[model samples]
Target: MTGPETDNESPETDDEPPEHRRYARYLELLESVQEADEAGLVAAVLRDDCVAMAESAVNRHLERRAAQLLTDAHFPDWARTTAAVIGDRAFLSRRLREWTLLRAIALDEPWTAEEVTGASDWFQRTAAAAQAVSSPEALDLLAEHGRTRRVRNAATLRLRPPRRRPG
Candidate 1:
């Protein structure tokens, strides 16, 4: 049974390209599917024409968006790795500036962070090895911040601080 055709009720098939770019290709492919004379194709179930194509594209876009959201929700692994590699102080500073996760982190950030941490670990291990080779001498430089000390030089032999009990 058919009546005067309307826009919404246009033949389950129409030559107009789908309204969007992504599904335009799918629509074209489906049109070819419709044209096939093989009974198998005709019977292959089109998902009810336009509705199927639109729904498929929406589902695809939603799936991709969900994956991106999930990755963002659990991005701390990269931050911790970054903290470990860049060294605690620099990592803290950079984190204060902006988290790598806050930026577009798809291609380069993760790889660069791994490399940084690897190099940092290597440097630490190397330093420990070198320190094991010989004991290094260190000097202690201390000053009494509140107390003033009289200078004892070749030109002046007098001292000003009391060496005995203050009581």
Candidate 2:
């Protein structure tokens, strides 16, 4: 018997929105996540195959998906909590690691060691301005382990604590 995979079929002919037609598959997956229960949503996001596909997706699709995931407060928070429990290999953790570097490429933010590995030459500059400030601990982390020499030096300069007045 011929299975659906083996059967010849034309592409989807439904009256989908024009913008979505270009990335219908990704939009469909994201729609399903919206419809899912809390547990189902987590399972879908955590799937290794889904994570891999997201990692390789073209920039437009990746940015759309990431922005949606981040904007919908519950999902990103849940992903973070889940990652804390399950470990860094969680899908969102890995995606955000890439997202950070992709974002940094545009605005001159320093790259973290874990964020810059295996990046390609093609990248979009995502930010208009550098972050106004970073926490001391965060600057310390970057000063110690930022991926480039420039990043390390810049972070070290920003790592100074606030001055105290005379007693």
- Spell out the clash pairs found in candidate 1: none
The per-model lDDT (C-alpha) reads 0.30, 0.43
Per-residue alpha-carbon lDDT of model 2 for 1-167, expressed as tens digits? 11112222346645554323323444345445443353343343334344444333323334455455543435445445445532454544555545544444433456653444333212111211124334454446556655555665666766666688999
| RMSD over all Cα atoms, model 2 | 10.6
lDDT per residue for candidate 1 within 1-167, as digits (tens), equals 11112133245546554333325443344345321232232222223355454445433432333234323644455344324433434433343223332222322233233322233322222212322212111000001110122211210221123368778
Candidate 2 regions with alpha-carbon error over 4 angstroms: 1-24, 27-51, 54-77, 80-133, 153-167
* Residue 87 in candidate 1, Cα distance off native in Å: 48
Give the clashing residue pairs of candidate 2, or none: 106-125
Q: Distance from true position, residue 94, model 2, in Å?
A: 4.9
Worst 10 residues of 1 by lDDT: 137-146
TM-score of each: 0.19, 0.34
User: Compared to the true structure, candidate 2 yields what TM-score?
Assistant: 0.34
Cα-lDDT of candidate 2: 0.43
Ten contiguous residues minimizing lDDT sum, candidate 2: 120-129
